[model samples]
Target: MTRIKKDFSLPAVFAGFITFLIGISVSSVLVIQAGQVLGANQAQISSWFWALGLSIGLSGLILSWKFKYPVATSWSTAGLALIIATGSGYNLNEAIGAFLICGIMTAVLGFFGIFQRILEFLPQSLTSAMLAGVLLKFGITLFTVMQDQLIYVLVLISTYFVSKKTLPRHSIVITLLACILLTPLFFEYTATKIHYGMTYPVWIQPEFHWSSILGLAIPLLIINMASQYLPGLAMIRSYGYKPHVNQLVSWTGIAQAIFAPFGAFSTNIAAISAAVSLDEQVHQDPAKRYIAGISCGVFYIFMGIFAATLTGLLLSFPREMITTLAAIALFATIGHNISIAFKEDLDRDAALITFLMSASGVQFLGIGSAFWGLVIGFIIYHLMRIQIKKPI
Candidate 1:
């Protein structure tokens, strides 16, 4: 604890704060939307915030403290998207049950070291490609929004580039500040009423059905593992962190299971936020970067305590601003992954195929493009290998 205190620095703490803000800004609305789709009332929606914030907060804190790595955790935004799309017929209780099943399955996979093994079998190029593919949508959206909000988007982009040149370490901070200053001019700003109180987690008793398990639970599990967890792990590995992958996975699953009854869908390693925490600007010494994770965890706990207020504030940001922020934050990550994906000559073609497949956003049998990208890439690599081995 003393050592942890000594390692803490203002930049690291700020980085964590920014990371938390990015995480919430990027996806809280989608989570709220998912809650509404499931017919959740106001209290249930608030419980979703409480459960997600507390679970991710505690997980990040515990993992960072134990491993001394910037092990950030976040709710599964993809899972929420899936729920909004496919969980229409399911009641809240059935959705809770599906959430529970997904958590248990995730935990089981982690306990058995399945995910780690799968990662081991994957080539670095393919994984990098997968990550790049996953992030391409955000990049596209950043420019697409410019069609409607031209001046605001231009200002945000200029601010980001200028800040990157002048103060690379605080580029995001500067960009966000610029956006905040400019937001009221371009958009209507309304402050939501803040209800100051401790948010209690509401437990919905699980009611499992075969339909929910097959349709909701399994798909949610697959999406989290392929689209979220895999990319997150790739980011961690790419940044040269040798995390206890199994422990991280297992613990997130455990945390989700514990909080699922409270409307928490799924929690997993955070790819975008984790990248923000790992930035060199956060801490010169990579060894001390765990302090950022700790700081983020502390902030998450605070967010959970005032879930209602924070949710309102997070929702107050306009869609374009949020999307732009997310795009800027992820820009470096996308570039790094793309570079890594095509670095090697032999794997270049396979990696590109994987990247295109992932970016295509194609889904089959309820699984996302990320999984299919990996599969197709692996098959292509093997085919190339077989061709090389055969007589010409």
Candidate 2:
């Protein structure tokens, strides 16, 4: 593909802005939900949102500007599971300690450039399986929603598919149009008031605990590196962009290290949802893709500053609309990850184990099953290899 000259045109920024605006509310809720579960007070929780928003937004803009690529940054989704696993009981101090250690580990991995190299070593099948596991909810959730509103869902699906084939660059627009037209028919909103205002950071001092290493630090560190970092690199590579892995990882860790005490759990590359912003319908050129992410970061910072207003809007938005739109937006990626996970003959069995384990949502002790998904996959793969080689 011929390179498209870098463009920082207003249209480009606006396109990126819209994409970010769409994704910010939903993604921020997930990030905030985790912090809230940890018993982070309002001030601290607000700061978590601010910290993540600022860190991701500013870092994304600066890096994308410097590299002239559509580079985006986000916190680890795996951290969500960790908050569920070790919520409330563990003081904020321990959580900060775990965050500090994990951030250091992530920066170290990036500094040595091992993140990209590990991407090479991971078997294609296992990576695919991991993605399938991550996206299972995306594929299934849409159909469940469709059952209640067949006409609307089908209309949206048809519009999206028809547009994807006929006017690929306009597919998202078609889906979006379908959503707006159908919203009133299916939406159950009795009230709607939008708010936007600035918020302040809430800071806390870090406290170290050796126990948190085994309890929280190791699992979070492992998941962020493997699930979020590795997959994010693969995502960018799959899009045919050469990401600056070392610098990206280094800064991600530094950002988290600085913000953890304020209730930020983990920050790194985003693998799964970055597609929503980077799709050709929104951003046509690989180099210009960073513009979409940069736009998203700015919106995220806006949410950070205007925490009260955005939070209320998010709380008041119609559930069905949000669910239906999210599920539909996620369909293509769900299909892609599923195929990668189970299609290879050599790695199918191990990949299956990984997928099942991760999707099971199992928690043993205080660590989530996602971390075990990697462990179990590697174990089963090597055990089978050893068995195959042994003398009869």
Candidate 3:
């Protein structure tokens, strides 16, 4: 205990907070888009912030504290896609109903231990291609920094390199410090002036519909589990920690169910981007990463309370800043995923199909690029298998 405590300190937790901010910033637009779908008026939009902030905070704290790993939580990107895709067709209540159904399905999947099998069915090649597709755009965006915000971008980039070289553990700290110091100097603060205030969760009642249950619920469950949950489990393992997937998934599902009325959308385990926290807090014993979770939770609750102001603050940042930072942060993973996407000779055809389809950003019946990316990968993979077995 003493050794672990000695390794982790308040400073480390603060570093995690910086990464947490960037992580939320990573996909928050999806959240905002979903909120708009639900007829999220000012207060309700603020409640969207409240729900996500509070959920992330509580979930991050409990899991990170309990497992001694930083278990990041985020609004379900898949769920957001579902709501946006079908939102106009369905009211908020029906969407919530779909969300609730998805949550229950996810919880049941975790409970029955079927999530392990689902990924196996997904084909590793397809999943890799889909992942590569999802992250490729952001990877390009990293270099897109030079187009705008060049000075601060260069400063942050230099800070990032220097911190890695000199401060090692403090690399992200230095990067964040650079962003804060440079924001006012080079960027227009007026662009980012958002209202900061307290917010309480606003509940939206769920109304069940067959269309929502099948169209939104089932697909949402698949995407959330395949893309979000499975990746989250791998994230923990990548950091050399044994993750309790069932416990994490089940708890996240149960919590999501509990919060649906307030437009919580979906809450689930995080990955890829969540890795930033793990890396930033590397020297700290893995178990102590909970402290970072705790800190993140604290910030989450704080933000939820001030959802309006914070939302404004988040909205205030130049769109390019958000896009570039997110894109740059993803550069490393995109390269790695692309390499893996093309790695297997057996899986090559499928992976390429998935990668191309996903990057194409084509919406087939509005299903989104990620879903089709996997679909194309699998189609190619199995089709090749069929071709090889046919009379030759």
Inter-residue clash pairs, candidate 2:
70-289, 70-290, 128-341, 129-341, 195-309, 197-306, 198-305, 199-305
Candidate 2 segments exceeding 4 Å error: 1-39, 191-195, 338-392
Best by TM-score: 1
lDDT of 2 by residue, 55-94 (tens): 7677766776677666667776657767665756577777
Q: Which residue pairs of candidate 1 clash?
A: none
TM-score, cand. 1 vs. native: 0.92
The whole-model C-alpha lDDT of candidate 1 against the native structure comes to: 0.86
Q: Write the per-residue lDDT of candidate 3 for residues 87-194, one digit (tens) a residue.
A: 887777888788788778878877877765555476655665676676676666766766766776777778777777887666655666666677777766585555
* TM-scores vs. true structure, each candidate: 0.92, 0.82, 0.82
Off by over 4 Å in 1: 387-392
- Candidate 3, residue 380: how far the Cα is off, in Å: 6.7
What lDDT tens digits, residue by residue, belong to model 1 across residues 1-392?
Answer: 79987897876787788778877887788988999999999888989889888989999999989998798888877788889999798999999999999999999999999999988988889988988888899899998999989989998999989988888767877887888899889988787876778888887999999999999999899889887788788878887788788999999999999999998799899876777787676776889988889889888888887899877777787888778877887788789889999998989889999999989988887678888998999998777777555577
lDDT of each: 0.86, 0.70, 0.69
**Model 3 — TM-score against the truth?**
0.82
Off by over 4 Å in 3: 1-7, 10-15, 26-33, 120-133, 191-196, 284-290, 331-360, 363-368, 371-392
363, model 1: CA deviation in Å? Answer: 1.7
